[model samples]
Target chain A: MTVMTTAPDKRDNAPILSVRDLKVHFPIPGKGLFAKDRPLKAVDGVDFDLYPGETLGVVGESGCGKSTLGRAILQLIAPSGGQVAWLGKNIVGIPHRDMQPLRRDLQIIFQDPLASLNPRMTIGEIIAEPLVTHKPELGKDEIKTRVKRMMARVGLLPQMINRYPHEFSGGQCQRIGIARAMILEPKLIVCDEPVSALDVSIQAQIVNLLQELQREFDLSLIFISHDLSIVRHICHRIMVLYLGNVMELADRDSIYANPKHPYTKALISAVPIPDPEIERNKERIVLTGDLPSPLSPPSGCVFRTRCPFAQEKCATDVPTIDRVSETQEVACHFHNSI
Target chain B: MMNKSEKTALLQSASAAKEIEGRSLWRDARIRLFRNKAAVGSMIILGIITLLAIIAPLLSPYAYDQIDWGYIQEGPNWENGHIFGTDGNGRDLFIRVLYGARVSLAVGLLATAVSLIIGVTYGAIAGYFGGKIDSIMMRFVDVLYSLPFMFFVIMLMVVFGRNIFLIFVALGAVEWLTMARIVRGQTLSLRRREFIEAAHATGVSNFKIIFRHVIPNVLGPVIVYMTLTIPQVILTESFLSFLGLGVQEPLTSWGVLISEGAKVIEASTWMLIYPAVFLALTLFCFNFIGDGLRDALDPKDR
Candidate 1:
């Protein structure tokens, strides 16, 4: 496969958010009275940086802890270990009272838009809630005006502001979610599968809306999704995660065209090409077996059990992320051989 | 025939027309409640009973405690002005029943309000802040639940000297245990919802989330429980009064009247029948309203 090269490195500028070796382990209760409590490693040792005016896509299978990583980055769920540096300040374990002010600059858009919005609150109230909390000095009329503008911007009518969440369709609700998140005009938004719950046609619209908004606001986004095609379309950089581990982090075109890791190769090959001619000729790599339980993930390499090119070394020793190219890093023992 | 801009304008107006006027959940529930025939009837009955309670003196010529020696134990003498006949005390049974409505309704309402306040707060705090606090608070509720409620009330009556105010407080204190449990269960489910997480993400204060988001959502069940609780409190108050531990003379409740009527049942059946019918009808009306509110407020019903 020919390597696809992109623009020159511009990463010297400080990242808006830097998450280093973040971990979120939930303790499973003991079955018996004297049984030892086991830790469920949902997100273990993940590292990434989200720069300003860029969309970093975190894509993985259902149980790969992509959602947990998104939440951990926002400090919604406290990381078990690691630094979540927001604008160079380590916000991990900070008191919620102290964190409240910082929340104005860091917001999140959830997957299930309807679920995320308070059912009792009107769309106006839902969108204005962030402002109410962060900007208490703003008058009610100012908040209302801002909410109406946001509603209109998100493709919703200003008059529809009083409608409840249930009154709106799924696509409209996602738009409301976007409006709510963007109402604060945050620097970074951790979109946890923002378009996953939407219909296919609606999904494209939401994705386009997000891209448009991101450009308009110059917003940095951490778009977490299981959909590879959607991620490839919107993200400048893509991070492949498996069982909470970062398998590969590379530029979008590099990751798709010349994926180094065996897992990434399998994932990219799984995305059926649009052209029937290319689709028929493409070689699909189907990995064997279900995902191992997070409670007792495979040793050395978590993906070794499902990886087709697993060897003795893959089981005995873990492969740390090795820099393959200027914009690509892969965590595999035999990336060249593969 | 239409141009692009005109077509877009027509479409916008069409969509605008399709936009139904916004109705709040409470307003929708109110409409649903009114549509329910039983609920509407019960509401009317409750209104009439409340009106009668307020104008008890105006409704009857004879005073509740008046001694009409000339017409002792007279039955249904509408012409003579003793409508529901005379009670054992020779007072107009109609007037006393109306007055009894006041005491019964007051006990029900005031006691339930006390319980609602205590229960919702205690439950919300316990449920919203789960884990150790939840376990400790719930365990305390369990301990309270284990205590013989009647014995507790009786003890309170003995200590507080059976004042009507004490009855209200005692009933509320006891009744709140269930309310706390119900509200806690609701809060447990509600606290985990994504909206709560969204609120947390927005840095909305914990108190605001609990009261504004959590409490309002759980209020469907709470309001239903409130209606049901009123009747329970009224019955408990009546039971206490029947045992001669509630409402002293000059202020007779339904329970007091019933107990007095039970003594003279063989001689004057109207005494027992009148008070009993009124109490039963009020309780039935309250229960109907409770059922209606539950169905109306239920999202499942929608």
Candidate 2:
């Protein structure tokens, strides 16, 4: 059911990051008895790009490999295949040791604020660690000064520098994370569901802070989340992913105004709009089916098994993403029909 | 990207707000531990025990190996200045016990250090790399662990033949297995941490990541393990000495002293009581310190 994306492509804005055919396969211990080699293809051949100073939101189900893609782009997980080019330089397949200089341009904000940080490191040390590794030439005072500056910008008190991560709330911890990431003045940052683990009210504050910080730093971001509304608020461009494949990619407002893929439709319809009048009027497209295991995903288009528009041809031919219009791209075959 | 003016403003504001700094879990835990009376008391007790262990040879009154023909098993003879009495051959018990403390503490400390070095390094490397290497190393540990270390030590004693140096080597060998497992488990968890990934992304060397970043992260448990490990080695050395396998005859430890006394418990009970009491006291002190350190170093509690 591809009759969704109608917007035009806006690629002329110099793209800052491009990830082509990225795949992250986790070799989970083999099957029963015979022990067949069936790897959990977490992120299989996903393609996307980020232009300068814009947020590219990746929304998906829990096991959709969205987080894996973010890590692979940073070469943290070492993608099994594909190209991750940062400013025309291929970063994949290089030793992590050699990738150090490029690190300043790419950073990440993790989902679990507390787990991601070293509980042993102080707030100042946490922010300073990146600078120490990337900008070792900087003197100790300069490092400390930069770290303090970032902390203050994030709204943390100077006295809190001596405190451990356990002392901070979920929101404060995320601010620390943003401080750490932006301290290096990175050109691109992968935000792996940074606000998912925080309180609801804290989420907006973090999002607003991120937007402001993104603008202040002129940073391009890969905002990974399952929260549709939150994604809609921050991301200029949004990609809907399923299992390990991209289902739809379009401008944020266009997708919200007219979600194309059945999966995207389900995600938007499930947002539980607060206004009773609007909520009652909008029908929820509740698709009853568990997400298929990545280890043995169904044949052809990953969404065919659940799609109401699934046809005989859908099972035999894989749907490759095609630009339907200047503003939208959809993978499903029937793009012309509504 | 932010325009130059806005970027400068952000930087200026950031400079004004630069107040927060990161502190590690270790430092935090230590602060908590300092506040715990029982933990602090244990620390003092263990410290005293360590000091005594190191200074035993310097403080002993009688000569360790000299035999007195006139004072065989003599109890506190003023002429010989033997405060703890004498052994069957009139070798000064007090002097022998002091020298024994030197030998026992040396073996305990050195052996534990050896194992910790071998274990932490091996475990961190294997677990961090985590492939065929991890599988091989872990299975090796599993095989070694399943075998009774005490029996293995006895077999080693018989195989390599018994020697004083062999005792440390054997104990170190067995203890390495334990330390390796502990460090490996720590490395496994620490390797998955975001800071570790952050370190990798920032171009930090693998060696630094393992030793500085990852190992230090899991050091709380490693340290707790080490404290308890020291006592374990001490007890093992004592058991070996009791079985006629440690410190030889001329060189004695609290273990040897206790064994020497155990031989004649039916008669003069002072010999067994002194050494046994000393060994028990040392072990208890270590245990107290271990509990204290665990509480002091707990990240969550901090």
Candidate 3:
């Protein structure tokens, strides 16, 4: 009953969250008064619609703004530009005081689980904090009962409530983080590499627990991670990002079976196959140059610097996202030929 | 019925386990502090000194300010019951030194408490908020920092009139600047920490985050600074008293005793020796305690 439901059949219903052309450009500090200010475009012009209960995996390499995009979506880091609409209401540029009531439905889980939990606070206090903030009317006994129950659901012993975060192991700490996020019963949770810090075996457990919770709560998730294999396992739709731009957006099966973008193709191929025979025979496309500096990105296609099939035209013309199929979108000028 | 009994038994055992106090970071630091011989020894010595200061009036027969012209400039002689002997004015140095301890210790503790309150709140807010608010707040700190230490204290004394409480307010106001700077620097690094970010994401108000999250995390350094600040505040008070801007004549401080002792040191050296020894011992104890706290509270060392 807790198994992940991968169906994208909920298109008939309205999207719970809509992010249109979201941009988070961080301005660099200039040396002198006359010096031109350079802005690092962390999440450049990202657009996505998340239906209820759908998980959108944002895949990228290190420093590709996957985490920034996730944070921007939840308004943890304010968006420099664009609209983040929650139930057709624009949440961008809203004062934090106003954002408080809306935050009950929007939550986040961090990458480093242990780092996310405060060292001074006990597990009970940490989990109960959200409840204490949002639901002031709740009795102390009621909050404790809810926290203890949430702790149990997240696989942490309720008896360990008085223990500090440092007393718990990494996996248990992550459970505490999950318990805190879940206590609010948030409608949309931006899971920013939730299981990346855990061991492979532990990652499966955390991922499984997330799926179970999602099903139970009917929650939508924006799962951000660099690991494609884990993203493929849980995410219903995957969005491939490179240097703060989406290279491809496709359904999970379509992304794995037939990735259209050159960057996505390289990324998918890099994932190690389980079987030795297939792994040895599979062709690998290893791009040569390092990730271009986002400070001064390439003029046209951001990927053209490290692209395998780059041409003169690739440098001169920026490629807009083209709908190649009903389930897939590729951002490459020569995607059809290639 | 069996399940109910088992659940109760489990809860009872858990409660019993909880009786052994949880080993928090503060508790861990305390254990480490006791393990350091110098710190624990200093603590005992400081405790003795404080006790003596508190009960000085009860212990001594002669009043702190009583003049005995019969035994003027007398050396350490128990025959007259002045163990530390008498000064030029024939005032018993023993009673004077104990009374001095009272003033010095009071100034040290009260002034440090004042600084801690102002510095921690000001620094934590500046660091947590950042941006334009941080710039403006820190600039104000910088402006305050530029004032000459002696000049500022002298001005404050002139304006507020000379009193022990005024001295406390003056020293605290001056010293809290450095503390605020230290706290602000600490808070800057802590600002980027994931827990602070987590708190923000959890919809905690900025004010609440500063108090509950930021202030507690910065306390290790703040506490260590506080221990060190006590000694500094004591010395500053002594310097002020030496200049005759501090405590008035009837109520003498270590500085007053030392200043009077310096004037007559050629004739009677114990007058200088006794008060000097007490002041030095107290400063040393505070320094050692501060060192111990730094070692204990430092997470890197752990």
True contacts kept of each: 0.49, 0.59, 0.39
Per-chain TM-score (chain B), model 3:
0.92
Q: Write the per-residue lDDT of candidate 2 for residues B1-302, one digit (tens) a residue.
A: 45547756665665465345555566667787788787677678767766766676676665689898878887766565877888888887877776777888788889999998898899989889998999998999889778887787788788988788888888898898978888888788778787787666666678878876787777788888998998899999998888888877687888889988989987777778777777787787778777878888864553
What DockQ does each candidate score versus the true complex, computed on alpha carbons?
0.50, 0.44, 0.43
| RMSD of candidate 2 to true structure, Å | 4.6
Candidate 3, residues A1-338: lDDT per residue as tens digits?
13455765776999999989999999997789889889998888988889999999999999999999988887888899999999999999998778889988888898899899888888898999999999989999999889987987777767787888888888889889999999999999999999989998889878988988998999899999988888888999999999999999999989899989999999999999999999999999998888888888899999999998999999999899999888899999988888
Question: What is the C-alpha lDDT profile of model 2 across A1-338, one tens digit per residue?
Answer: 11222222446675677889989998887758878677899999988878888889999998999988888998888899999888877888987556877888888998899887777667777888888877789999999777766776776765577778888998999999899889888998899999999988889878978887877887788999998888888888999999989999999887888877778888999998889999899888778788999988989988888887788988999998988666678888875664
Model 3 interface Cα RMSD in Å: 3.3
lDDT for position B221 in model 3:
90
| Distance from true location, Cα of B9 in model 2, Å | 12
Q: List the residue pairs that clash in candidate 3.
A: none
Residue A191 in candidate 3 has what lDDT? 93
The top-ranked prediction according to DockQ is 1
Q: List the residue pairs that clash in candidate 1.
A: none
Q: List lDDT for all candidates, in order.
A: 0.89, 0.82, 0.89
